[model samples]
Target: MSVLTTKEIMDIIPHRHPFLLVDTIEELVPGVRAAGKKCVTYDEYYFRGHFPQEPVMPGVLIIEALAQVGAVCILSCEKFKGKTAYFGGINNCRFKKKVVPGDVLMLETELIKQKGPVAIARATATVDGKVAATAELTVAIG
Candidate 1:
């Protein structure tokens, strides 16, 4: 069961079409953790320019997707409601595999720590149970 639909996710995050990478929130614990999904398709706008022959989902976008999931976890909390989570920094980021069309990216983020308006989360993006990307993200809620 989905914890939040695309429409509901839109209400929580400011991202819109072409940029909103998260398709559904499968699991969520406000201010703690979140698990989301993004189904990469051949029709994605990025595919047009990212690579005409062998299209692959950009690594930066994969990080962005993970960040969006972290945002949902933080912004959904009553204390942080209506606030935006900005990327303060990214650390230990590593891309392990290529994500391409027809892949369903499973994104997960766990809020590991927080100080004032700043928070840190361990994030990961996986495809078919294989790690595609991993990072420690620092976010500032404002």
Candidate 2:
């Protein structure tokens, strides 16, 4: 229906501060697909320790960003409202480019399968229409 803001996401997922990778969800279709964004900045906490001399958003965080998008897809369910969605596992993850400060990452996710409380999703991160990273995320309603 409508896009979700950071506050709404905060209500659905338990992530906060540096751990919350997604800024806003642009589109959501519950059991089908979703899209979101995160604006990387030089002020991000991870960039400080990820590299002191040359700041680079860690590949793991990038995957986490994609997984967070998947989280949004699963939590779009009404039954899961006010519940915490945790990343159960990740598979087939690949990084094609390095994400740095000032990059606006676009996260896209599609629901692949689900069994009861667990769901699997395929996701990708892009910038300027180029793939930055991709992953298969598994989430559990907790």
Candidate 3:
């Protein structure tokens, strides 16, 4: 079961179709953590040019998905509601596996630190229980 559908996620984040990566949020704790999923399909816009022969989900997009999950966590808070979370920075990022069509990317992010309008989170993306990517993200709310 999902805690937030794509529509609900859109209500929280300022992302639209062809750019919004997360399909469903399964778990969430305002200002703390979130878990979401993205179903990879061959029809995704990026696949059209990213490698016509053997399409692969972009590594940056994996991090963006994680950031979006973190944004949902932060933006859902009473104080931060209606605010935008900008990417302050990305640290210690690593990609372990290639995500492809038919893969369900399971994304998780935990808010590790926050000060004033800036925050940090530990993020990870997986497919079939295997790590696809991991990173530390810095976000600034405005």
Encode model 1's per-residue lDDT on 2-79: one tens digit a residue: 999999999999999989999999999998999999999999999999998999999999999999999999999998
What overall lDDT goes with each candidate model?
A: 0.97, 0.88, 0.96
Where model 3 places Cα greater than 4 Å from the true spot, the runs are none
Which stretch of 10 consecutive residues in model 3 shows the poorest summed lDDT? 15-24
* Candidate 1 weakest lDDT stretch, 10 residues: 76-85
Local lDDT at 33 for model 1: 97
Deviation (Å) of 137 in candidate 1: 0.5
Give one digit per residue, the lDDT tens place, for model 3 in 1-142. Answer: 9999999999999999888999999999999999999999999999998889999999999999999999999999999999999999999999999999999999999999999889999999999999999999999998
Better by TM-score, candidate 3 or 2: 3
Residue 40 CA error for candidate 1 (Å)?
A: 0.5
Better of 1 and 2 by TM-score: 1
List RMSD in Å for every model shown.
Answer: 0.6, 1.6, 0.5
Clashes of each: 0, 0, 0
